[model samples]
Target: MKTFARLVDDSANFSSDITYKKGGSILSMIETVLGKSVFQSALQSYIRTYQFSNADHEMLFEKFTEAAAGTVKDWCERPMNVTRFLDPWFLQQASALKK
Candidate 1:
C-alpha cells in the first residue's frame, strides 16, 4: 500500500503502488487452506451476492465458510481467532503467510 509521490507529503502528483499488494498471496492462502474449486465458487458467489450491495468482512467470511463445505469442511468448521487470522496479512504493509 505504498504511495508513489515526490519528496513532499502533500504532493499533488501522488499515486498508489499496487505492485507490492498482497491480494495474490491472500487468495493463494485461501485456496490452499480451502480448495481451488471452493475458493473460486465462493468468490463468484460473493461477487454475485454483493454486486449491488455493500459487504463487510464478516459477510465475506460467512460466504467463504458456507461455500467451503465438504471441500475443507474440517478447516472451515474449526474455530480460530478472527482478529489473529486477518490482522497479519491485512494490517502489515508487506506480509504473506506460507501456511
Candidate 2:
C-alpha cells in the first residue's frame, strides 16, 4: 500500500481508489482522532490562513496542534506532538492500520 502522500512518477496511473477512497478514509480517521469540533476548527483555520495559496502538511498540522493544545495529552493519554504523531501516517503506508 502506498502512503496518502506518496510521490507520483510520470508513468503513474493515479487510480481513483487511491485518490478518493483511501484519501477519504484517512481524512475520516484524522477527524475521528481530533474530534469533529477540533478538526473542523483547524480545517477552517487552515483554509482561511492559506486560501488561494500553497500550504503543506506541516502547516496544517501546526494548526491542529495549536487547536489541540492542552487537550491533546488528555485525548492521547500522553504528551505528544501532533505533527510527530501524524507524520508516520502521512509519510509511510500501512502504518495507520497497525494502530
Candidate 3:
C-alpha cells in the first residue's frame, strides 16, 4: 500500500482504487517472497516516519477511493460480493496434482 501510494502521490487518484484481491492462492504467492520479513520491517520504518501525522488506514482508504473512480473501469477490478464460498478463486483443480 505504501509503494502504491507513493507511485500516485503526484495525482489525486486515490479514491478510485478498487483492487482487493481475494484469498485464493495469495498465501502461496506471499510465501514466494523469501525476504518478506525484511521488506516489512523497512516498510514499518517508513510508516513510523509519518505516523505522527495521524495518517492511517482510514485516510489511506479515503485516498484509494478517489484514485479508483478517477481511472477507467478497466484500471482495476472491484471486490466480489458473494453469498457463498463456492467461487473458483478458493478452489484448486484436483487434476493439477501429480499424485
Candidate 4:
C-alpha cells in the first residue's frame, strides 16, 4: 500500500508552514490529538479491509469509512442533528472539504 510518511520537526518549521496548505490543514487536527492511537487504527483497518477491492481514491475512502464505522463507529459520525462535527452539513460543505 502507498503511504504518505512526510514528517516535519522544529528546525523545518518554515518549510512546514509553506507546505502545510498542500495537506489541507490536517496537520493541526492530527497534532491536536497526537497520542490518540485508537483513532490511528483506522489506517490498519483501511489497509486490511479495502486494500484489494477498491482501487480508486473515492471508493477507497468509502470503504475505509465503512470499516471505521464497524471498528470505531463512534468517531465516524459527524454532527448532523447531534453535536458531532462542530458545524452543520451546509457549513461543513462550505468549509474546506478536502480533509
Candidate 5:
C-alpha cells in the first residue's frame, strides 16, 4: 500500500481504490483502536477547533492524543501516542498491519 503522503505527489495515485477503499479501511482501524466514543469525540473536537482554519495531520493527531488520555498506548498494545501509532500508516509506504 502506498502511504497517504505519497498520493499527494502524483495525481496518478488519486483513485477511488486508494482514497475511498483504503482510506475507509484505515479509518475503520483507527476508530476501532481508539474506541467509538473517543474517536468520535476527537473528530468532533478537531472539526470544531479547525472548522474555519487550516489543520494538518499533527494538529489532528494532537486532538486524538488529547482525547485518548493515555489510552492509546493500551489500545495499540505499545507505548505510543496517536502520532507515533499513525506515522507508519500515513508516512511509510507499507502495510501498517501488525501481527
Candidate 6:
C-alpha cells in the first residue's frame, strides 16, 4: 500500500490485508534498530507522558529518536530525523520491509 489510513470509518467494513500487518512490521523494525528493552522503555515513556493527553505523531517520533540515540550502540548512529527514517517504511509499498 502507498499509504495507510490513520483512522478507519466506523461505517466502513474492515478488511484483513498486508497493510494491516505493516504497523506491526514497523514496530518490529524499531525493535530491531533499537534494542527491545530500549524500544519498550521508549513506548512506556510515550504512553506515560501522553496518557489522557492527545499526542501527535511528532511526539512519538521525538520520543523514539531520543530513546534510540541514548541507547543504540555507536555503530548504528543515524543522522536523519526519526520521522524521516520511518516514513519510507510507512508510506511506501510493502516491499520496503525486505530491507
- TM-scores for all candidates: the values are 0.57, 0.70, 0.24, 0.32, 0.71, 0.66
lDDT per model vs. reference: 0.66, 0.76, 0.35, 0.42, 0.79, 0.73
Candidate 2 least-lDDT 10 residues:
10-19
* Highest lDDT scorer: 5
As a whole number from 0 to 100, the lDDT of residue 78 in candidate 2 is 68
Instruction: List candidate 3 stretches off by more than 4 Å.
Output: 1-18, 22-34, 54-99
lDDT of 4 by residue, 8-60 (tens): 55663546644546444543443233224533554566577677774544443
Worst 10 residues of 5 by lDDT: 3-12
lDDT of 2 by residue, 2-70 (tens): 668767674456564565676677678778877899889989999999999999989988998887776
Error (Å) of candidate 3 at residue 51 is: 0.6
TM-score of 3: 0.24
Instruction: Let me know the TM-score candidate 2 reaches against the reference structure.
Output: 0.70
Task: Tell me the spans in candidate 2 whose CA falls farther than 4 Å from its real position.
Answer: 1-11, 74-76, 94-99
lDDT of 1 at 56: 80
Tens-digit lDDT track for model 5 on 1-99? 775654355655656466676667777887988899999999999999999999998898888889888666664476448887787787655467563
Q: List the lowest-lDDT window of 10 residues for candidate 1.
A: 11-20
The model with the greatest TM-score is 5
Runs in model 4 lying further than 4 Å from the true structure: 1-24, 27-35, 55-99
lDDT of 2 at 88: 71
Between candidates 5 and 6, which one is better according to TM-score? 5
Error of 6 at 76 (Å): 7.0
